[model samples]
Target: MTIDSDADADRERLRELIDELAVVRGRVTLSSGREADYYIDLRRITLHHEASRLVGRVMLRMLDEAGIGCAAVGGLTMGADPVATAIMHAAGAEDRAVDAFVVRKAQKSYGMGRQVEGPSVEGRRVVVLEDTSTTGGSALTAVEGVRAAGGEVEAVAVLVDRDTGAAEHIRETAGVPYLYAYSKSDFGLE
Candidate 1:
């Protein structure tokens, strides 16, 4: 399928931002437990205004292409927060409303004592997003949390794939198709 011009532009802009902010160098250990010569510090981009907007647009386009219905978008906190906020804003601009959520690393110590915060996902179609995926463990943790809360996760999307086999691992273990906007090869690090 063809990507719309606006979406393509957004994706390209995000690529450029990643190239500027993410470190490209020698071997390094990633959270995914894999070795990589380059690392995409997605936090760097997510914290930047333009980069965050581009990410939101790209992710929305990807969700449209996948034909996945989602009422809410979220993932393991911190990394997914900015993307989810951007997505919610972008979707609203398009007249398609979507809620954003955050899955805490640990259950809250008080109140409702919830792990997934923001809105009730029960019976809603949700998409769990991540800034980067290396081993896919963190993303899966969010997915499982969403599932346990009764949200049907249609898929998972990450900003970068380090080519560390995380995508395959997610597909096999979680049974959810993993999507990424860029890969190591795309950044000329492969």
Candidate 2:
């Protein structure tokens, strides 16, 4: 298959998984504090045995396609944890040198006093990953924390975009490219 077609197939399978597992249909308030008819709780997929590999493959493809080369990938803790680790595993499978880090909401009070943890993002190009993004708060915060830890902000990427202004918000606020592996339309929502 052609490269584009292969990418399309990967995306299709990822979407199928989301539709079957991650997509929650009902009233819900997102972390961004907005009410929605449907919510994409990507953890359900990102933590799954099969779907996690798919998440890793799809997101790694997205980054390579964007010409975004990062030595490390991660973002604000809970939401970004699995996504970052998945990407790291994917890169490892390809023999790519990629590490994963975690960005804490705040610096710890003691014991090395770190806000960014893992293989040391110090002076490395890093991409911030989010499971789902809405207003861009979590991603932006991660970008800030990474920068403070001396990591170069390569870009911010999300597994799923809620399409609630995160792309533009991150662009305007962080001055970095914002990318998503899937969007509201990918899940056949809205």
Candidate 3:
């Protein structure tokens, strides 16, 4: 979806914040098991006070502009945790109805024995959020978890796209649109 000009500044600000706070130059092994010269450690921004606020606002605009209405926003834990909360709070400030959920790696052996936590995903449309994606495995896993809990997977929304195969991989594998706010060029990484 095309973000309007008003959001252009917000998206640009987020790109700048990512360049300043999230980019890490060094050899690193990604969650996708791929080696990278630099890592977009988005938690640096996703958890940052100012940057997190931008994340919420920009991501919410992205979703809204895409016309993806949903009852909840969330994805796999850790990376998706703050991002989801950011969107939830942002939507609330705008008086939009949105909840958040966490997808556990595996169902807890105890407690409610649930793999998906927070507001029940049963019979609701949801957009999964991820800080960044290389293989799209995390977001796809969240999709499976949500489906298992009876939620309709609307789309997979990522804060950044690595220009890797994740986008294509997610679309082919999950049969849903994969949306992202920025790409490598946004931070001059490409």
Ranking by TM-score: 2, 3, 1
Across residues 1-190, which tens digit of lDDT does each residue of candidate 3 receive? 4547757887888899999999988899998889988899999999998999899999999898899889998999999999999999999988988999999988899988999999998999999889999999999999999999999999999999999999999999999999999997788785
Cα lDDT computed for each candidate against the true fold: 0.86, 0.92, 0.92
Q: State in Å the error of residue 182, model 1.
A: 1.1
Q: Write one digit per residue (lDDT tens) for candidate 2, span 1-190.
A: 8978877887888899999998999999987788999988888998999889988889999999899999999999999999999999999999998999999999999999999999999989999999999899999999999999999998999998988899999999999999998889877788
Candidate 1: list runs displaced more than 4 Å.
1-3
Clashing pairs for predicted structure model 1, backbone only = none
Tens digits of per-residue lDDT for model 1, 4-73: 7767778887888889887567778877667777767888888787888788888888888878779999
Better of 1 and 2 by lDDT: 2
Evaluated at residue 85, the lDDT of candidate 2 is: 93
15: Cα error in model 2, Å: 0.8
**lDDT of model 1, residue 92:** 89
